[model samples]
Target: MNPIKLNLTGSPREIGIQHGRALYEQIRSQISIYESMFQYTSKISWSDVRDIAKEFKSPLQSLVPHIYSEMEGIAEGAELDIFDIVALNCRSEIALGRFSDGCTALSWKKSNNARVLSQNWDWTATVKNNLAMVSIEQIGKPTIYMVTEAGIVGKIGFNSAGVGTCLNAIRAKPMISSKLPIHVALRLCLESTSVGSAVKTLESLGGVASAQHILVSDSTQSLGLELSPVGNKYLTEDASGLIAHSNHFIENHYVEEPPWLSGSPIRLDRIRYLAHELIANGVSGDTITPGLLRERIFSDTYNAPQAICCKEDESRHISTRSSSLFNIVMNLNSEAPSAEVVFGRVGSGEEGPVLKMPWV
Candidate 1:
């Protein structure tokens, strides 16, 4: 399906209302699917989900009023209750064990002055049909473009400020509370004008419900942050100017090993090796175009269900029936930051036409 393009502006609530109404049916369908997934995976009922969603309201409104306003707008526009929308926003936290896997890489060359940030969003195959590309123009913020599931405010994308972000789910023992959830934090990151601001925005959230690896990049710099409910740490690129992360934590002494990180270690090593190999072969800067990156790296399906381009594995309890839902590559150095989204998985040999999103 063609991605829905939404140009939203005005007050926070107004922007959200426009977003919700424009994709109301898609939002409804997403909610239904998430509800079933929750029931089947965690045995959590709709009533419990609503109650849990309400728990984040006070913190969200007090800390990030704009995001709250957007959620309210989504509720009103989609004709669903405010708590229902909140449930969708916090689904990652609510359904902790069922999170997806991902791979992110950043590379640049001083000689040729080319740079790129790329990621493959691995998730439930069903989400492939529900994805949408949302372009948001809001007051007091840079224009943002994101590829997200309906009813979700953020995932992977870049902003007009030449800042881009990619996410990888991580697991840590004894989850705790924080001022904001990861999805909301993702929106905050995209709203940032620079890499420093993006890092500060995430650091400001003293605690988080779950763990995540937020890979952020700007025209000149790239950072990989490991955030958990307890604390956060970060890693920068080595001499090769290559930084990559999968679903597991790589920072030193962050937390106990996440038991749910199935195939994470292998995938992490594989992606890191591939990225370095490309760097050694002079695939950096403009030389590392999106198609070349896809063809050389993401198209590798060596490990079947656990490869860089993941295939479905029904037997796995965590990512049961999950595959690469989308692939995105961003040119952070461009005058108008832009991204290319491949709607389906890259390695499956069925990737859809590339959708170019030039900054507005």
Candidate 2:
């Protein structure tokens, strides 16, 4: 174990400020790089950004500038042009915003009937900016957040509440007035009191405008909820039993993939194989360990593709703005959900808590 580093028990507001400071003091340069990149990568309007930001409880929005600066430094170090930066950001949003239709959910009860074992995942992108390796040991626990310039963004974490939330993204048509940035909405959902509330947060409050989400909450009872938001359309599949997910849309009509980026399809294929392999290898619902979870996401397939690469068309490449450090996982028990931040190697070198805010 990493000896349970970082303090996780705090209100959403407190963690949001911590995220701001982490970015300002540790990753300001990288955040700046991303700010410029986001202009083109994200189709959202400045009005939308401001509007979505308005939903935040003042303290979180105050850190946006600080986070932007940190991203800029990462861009400068990598020599990314404006388009390259935007494309990279867009690619990452696709990775973080979308949800896999295959994931299963768990429902909590008043019994210790189920337990978490471990988590292992191996993440790879077409660019160095998105390369990562991580593993989690032990059962479902809490993953806390740290204040980066971007407020309290929960990169990864498990909770005593038996909830495990991972974020990914996919592309869609340009969002106008109705579309909201996913990060803002996710922050709100993370702060929510329960999964039901989290779903409401995304729907009633800070709408993703255009995005996909995979929410996994295990209350000792398996229940998986996959939410997809693209424009005015909303779709979800409740497979709250035994299942897994990857980077692909589920519904046929609503499978809104932009085709601007590639590789996720292949990743999904690998996910299928890995899921079966784990199950066959004696991994069960309650016994899934963090180390196993990491492998499921990041393990290298003998003939599978590598994550980072320098491409001729920079738009196709991933960057730190896309991903620099793979945030480690935090396990959660039966408690209120909080942000379990996984620090990236490139950004802050260590993660601040990713707060689960209360908008959902």
Candidate 3:
């Protein structure tokens, strides 16, 4: 399916208004899905969603005014309350209160000295049709090209400054918080001009509301940041110049695991094994192109629904009836900064059409 594209510019509110108006229907659809999921999974009423969202309003406004403006614009355009938009942006934190097991991200330096980042966003099938690709151009910030659900401002993507990022949902004991949400943190990372700046941006947040793993890289370096409500830690590349993260923490001492992540350990082990095997079998950076990365590694259905490229299975205990929303592979070393996004899962021996961004 073709994803909606929103090319927005100007002040944060203006940009957000344009985004919300242009994708108003999609945003509405997303809200509906979230509402249903919250009801079914957490028994959370919309009233409570709004109330929880309100608690963060002051903090969000103080920490990121531009994002607040953008969210305000979204609310205005979508004809929804500002708190609704805030709730959507904080979906990770709220939803994690009930369920948490989705998303996978990896970053590695190519043998040719280039850097690449890849991720598979696995989520409830409800918003499958509500996804969009957004390009945000701000006056003094790095241009952001991200793939996100409607209404929510940020999820995954890279920037024009050669900095790229991918996100994975992680769980911590007592998951909810009142600090910066993961989605907002993601936008902050995309706004960063470099890897260091991105790390610093996250570090500056002091704390966040939920646990998340951010796989970030630039032309020069790659790192994985595990963020929690209490503290954060950095996970650097291993001796093989590769780092992969799933729904659970590999840096065990850094955080505690939520109970619903039984499949996380398997997924993490599979990715690490595959990555190392690829390198050991002579799949060097020169051979690890975007297509290969998607088809060979991310698409592996070794364990069915729990594989790197997940599929929905109703029988599984930890399944969310989720499928791959999209697989994004970015070449951070590209002169103009580019990415390849394949909507939906990459089936066995089936190569789907890959959409290249910033059309050459």
Top candidate (lDDT): 3
Per-residue CA lDDT of model 3 for 124-201, tens digit only, reads: 767878988889999999889989888887778898987888988876754545578988888988999888998888
Where is model 1 poorest over a 10-residue stretch in terms of lDDT? 106-115
lDDT of each candidate versus the true structure? 0.77, 0.36, 0.81
Model 2 TM-score, 2 decimals: 0.56
Candidate 1 C-alpha error for residue 79, in Å: 0.3
**TM, every model:** 0.94, 0.56, 0.94
lDDT of 3 at 65: 83
RMSD of each: 2.1, 9.8, 2.0
Clashes of 3: 0
What's the CA RMSD of model 1 in angstroms?
Answer: 2.1
lDDT of 2 by residue, 1-360 (tens): 021223422333343333333333223344344443344446544334334433332322343332233223333434433222222322333333322111112122222444331122222222223221212121232332322222223333344344455554444543432333454444444444355666665566445544444444444433333344443332332232233344445442354456543545554455455655766687665456444454454333322232221112234323222322333333444654332333332122243333232112
Give each model's clash number. 3, 127, 0
Which is better, 1 or 2, measured by lDDT?
Answer: 1
Candidate 1 off by > 4 Å: 100-114, 316-319
